[model samples]
Target: MKNEPVRSEAVGISEEILRKWEAKGVSRRDFIKFCTTMTATLALPLTFAPKIAAALEDKRLPVIWVEYQSCSGDSEAFLRANQPTAAEIILDIISLEYAEVVMAAAGHQAEKSKWDAMEKYKGKYLLIVEGSIPTGEGGVYCTVGGESAVESAKKLIKNAAATITVGTCASYGGLPAAAPNPTTAVGVRDLVPGATIVNLPGCPVNADNLTATLVHFLTFGKLPAVDAIGRPKFAYGKRIHDNCERRAHFDAGQYAESFDDAGHRQGHCLYKLGCKGPEAFHNCPTIRYNEGLSWPVMAGHGCIGCASPGFWDTMSPFYRRLPQVPGFGVEATADKIGLGLVGATAAAFAVHGVASAFRKGDAMESDKVKVEE
Candidate 1:
């Protein structure tokens, strides 16, 4: 018998992308798996995987990534993505026209590249801002190519189709806008009012979420739905507590009181140790960082609500408990609430059992009467 040649499963995927993936040792299965993962991350149906693949095959998205006042932690996180390596993302997904840290072009040449992209793809390219804009000192605090951060942001925002702010610094002013706010730093939204902006607010924004957000735009030709705070609902829809691994501990009132306690070692809930999971809305527990290896909570540390607005000040005193849980009162302890829920559930079941027995008895009595008749 003759052997059959292996058929390619590249389907709608472009040869260019396949070649790049092949060069990077990414298989067709791996590419599909990545697309599926992205589909789930976007909260889209699994059937959307093909659509996502098709979208990736379309024209490479023109993206202009700009940074101002930041530690570049978000950029670092973004570059560290391993599932779909940074090279794949940069080369296959987006035509990254301008980025200061990674681009080979420097000084005047770099500035020219950014300006050229903005002009060439006006109202077409996506703008990703990575730091806060300094409004103080006439915006002299942060400048790029002799242009003030404010001026640069205004121009970029004006010409781009939409702006995506990565990290808390770019979304809500972060540490730069913290107490005493020396630079009078503000986010891009503050600098360019009334512009369409998607805020991915985290100390170091999760790269997976950023990739998914871009995929959603490419697949649907529009940004994903956002919450009241301009954050994608798929990424920030539920509180971290809702899906935390220690949620069972929280519900059972098994809490770690101190860092050195036995409960801490046993993986008890860190609610008492200033975990803001109950009040913080993010997908950290589910999506996780470092390619889903683990998150802060999984590593025995509590979430500091780094994704929340004004987290620098509000989530401070990071080693203390929240004033109160959202629905429960300030005085109500987890134990009390947990007990109440258990008791209520037990009571409901007991009542249902008794009612069912009575109904059975009544039916028996009615049968007896019919027999006598």
Candidate 2:
């Protein structure tokens, strides 16, 4: 009789993790699929799937999640992660040493847990911050356990293996740091100069990105490559417009003039209605949200450019169209340029199509001659 493979257990994965996976209805095949999905999400080749799986099974990173001045929407999103589920990530994949939002401890006990984790993990744990740090009035605006936000962050970040700032609030001061900033809110990068911070900026960052970042670090022992502004290139390499569903409409010079217009009903481009897809750099259109269901534009709403720096000020007023398309002359409007380019683009495609057909015919004739010979 042939022996069946028992891979997960034989590979040194803890029985506890396997139990948790079983309880969560995640089979070994499901786990492998998850690893493959993560490999692809990180823009890594499928061959890296086994490496990612090994890392996840072997390394349980110690994580300390902190929050300061802003809504807890990012934490909420983190909790609702469906790919691995928050329970599996926190309990099985990572040793979440301290998280004020989810940990059972509270008050001084909570503070003690944080301090203890900091001391125990010391220079080894990952620090994940959710909101911006308030710098006004001696950082009195946001305090945790009698320590100001700045003071706590400074101490915590000093010895961290890496710091990940989730949400636009934590990445670029977000809404709190917008115009006439009262609390003088600033992001982790602003608070800690000379520190390498991985930024995942979104109104409420997609949990999958955060998970992928963690997995990348675990798999490779270093953070993924970042763009000029420190966002992972794999996730923010291209503008949303590059892969937007309405790109054809935009290229064809079709756009929605208002919220309830015929163009919108027919799924036309939202650029004229103030879509910032052309300027915003993110994987929202590809990775999507709510379990790969739909994104804002897909839901009939224009992109508000939440992923870009200081989008609240730069991309507003949200409903007003940009004067000119990016990478184009200032005098020419987007629709005008689109109209002019549409004709040229169509002509070029027609020419290319004809040439391709001719090439195919020539190839067929050559193949027939070779077969006869």
Candidate 3:
């Protein structure tokens, strides 16, 4: 990503938008603070924070947000971002041309606005898909503007600069593609092959991560470095287990066997209760949710591995630790192995102490005789 600031003229944010911010009583300083916070969240140095501000202030990228088979939870998460505030996000971050839930236009008018923005921005616009694309029965399961999810995505993504699949539904087909999926739902990667795609896979994706991603793109004119699955490294680099508040309990072989147990109430590890944290990677622990307040584990719930692929099928049934163990003779649960290893280590140390004492006694006795002679 480029370290230098983008020229104001290069960005598309309008003076009218700034006026709207002013009218809403949101100060310029508050907006800059939001940008700086987001830049830091992206793991970029504070120096790049101003660059982010410039990008957001001057070059507002047009976004066409489309929803398919979803509950709009992802949008709700985005709206609840406390730093930027939902109004600022709508009016300042990006030129949100059309969204079904947020836009005042309905039916044909709303669809027209989306197409108008698409034609105007064409290769420059960003396409954000919020839900899954159903392809069963000729894509008849889900429709917007009288077009199937598959058909709309295929057409709109053709000239888009990048496509972001928000939420697990759009990113990995989520719950819709779970057991006996009648809709034959598929993610954006499958629907729009070879397209520049970023998958923010969560039951409801983190709002801060989404904003940080857009800021990174604005500053660098390209998407941030991503992992194999197109997840931004800064956000999904480490497993939740690595930063869990109850990690000490896990290392000490202490775990909550059930939800209401004393161990759980005492804030012990929930691994035995089926936390997918060991196998899941996301910034949920660090960045957290709802203004850095808390995450699932902090709230006394184990991670369901919502951010990882095939989470619905692979991570469940939730409330039990992962079962598969590699590099072992027999299948062993983490708790069983942890306790066994601890016991074995203690036994070995005890045996070594006994042997060392005997050797020391023999050497001391010989030295005493030499002194006497």
Candidate 4:
């Protein structure tokens, strides 16, 4: 995407040289566009705007991506990120050296190229891993070229500036690590315990999450602060149901019973229809998908919460809400159990009011007789 204005960071060149070659200074329009969007995504203060602009002007960072036992769907989702701008956006800003899926190199040549890049820019490139590492059967389950997946990971991670685990596969072991775990699938953290890992926990995470993370790393010169699961707080912090468009309908008790129901046409809440946005975390609603085309909830569907740890085991059925969540024992479905209590309390109050009226009537008669006496 470079056009003499934005130079690639693959050459191991210093910032001073790149700064001079930078023909196109970040435009006022483009800089503000990114600042505004990033402010909303990260909820940063207005004061950080100047810092973000400075970060953009800084030399682009280099990245190397690896795939393990995954479907490559997360990369596909990132490929759809059509934001910031054609020249100064997230992907455009970073120098991507090696990614098996999109890399133009092939066969033995491809493997050689990746190694060369790693060695050339050791400790300077971000390592992004998609999919899970298989530990079963001597790691024979997944072999690239002649090396095992785990072995390759060990080699690359030692010198990586930072690591980003993309998708549920790389973050939580995905379906491959499910019960029985025939493949003995493990996330990047499981294999490389020493590295600071960032987990984007989704079956196919939103592209904006990926971009935001890269931006954060670029701006801060280190990975952003993450939660217990190693996910950056900005993207994976809030629940989808919080900012959902149909959240109003949810509060009002309006629901869509089924796909064929009238509520579907009326655009009622899909909470009852198995929308898992309430518990699921991510910026899907706000970022949407496919350049603001549509997200799962907007299309009249529910989230499966593929991002949650042990999601394959705990968040099963994908459609039904959790009956009992992790660390929450005896938890009932919020709607059914809560409404039931409220309804019973209202009924009991109504019966007590009737009894009180009868008692008051008899007391009034007794008082009149006493006065006559």
Which candidate leads the pack in lDDT? Answer: 1
List candidate 3 stretches off by more than 4 Å.
Answer: 1-24, 27-29, 324-373
Better-scoring candidate (TM-score), 1 or 2: 1
Per-residue lDDT over 1-373 for candidate 3, one digit per residue giving the tens place of the 0 to 100 score: 1233433233323445444445656654455456567766898776665566557655678999999999999989888888778777777668898888788899898889988998999999988889888899999999887888888899888978998889988988889987688899888998877889888889899998998888888888888887767788788776677778898887676888889999999999887777767667788988898888999999999999887666476566676444321222213332333324323332433454423433434324532211100
Which lDDT tens digits does candidate 1 get at residues 1-373?
A: 0123222354344556655555656676568668878988888877677678778774599999999999999899988997688888888889999988799999999999999999999999999999888999899998888999998999999999999999999998988998889999998888877899999999899999999998888889888888767789889877677789998887677889899999999999998787878667778988898778999999999999888777587677678655344353334333334323322332433455423433434324532211100
Residue 153 shift from truth in candidate 1, angstroms: 0.4
TM-score of each: 0.83, 0.82, 0.80, 0.77
lDDT of 1: 0.79
**C-alpha lDDT (0 to 100) for residue 174 of candidate 1:** 89
Q: Choose 3 or 4, whichever is better by TM-score.
A: 3
lDDT of each: 0.79, 0.79, 0.74, 0.70
Residues 317-338, candidate 2, lDDT per residue (tens digit)? 7776543343432233323433
Lowest summed-lDDT stretch of 10 residues in model 4?
Answer: 364-373
Residue 61 of model 1 has an lDDT of 94
For model 4, how does the per-residue alpha-carbon lDDT over 14-76 read when each residue is reduced to its tens digit? 355344334456443434555556656776775665565567564668889899899999888
- The root-mean-square deviation over C-alpha atoms between each candidate and the true structure, in angstroms, is 12.5, 11.9, 12.6, 12.5
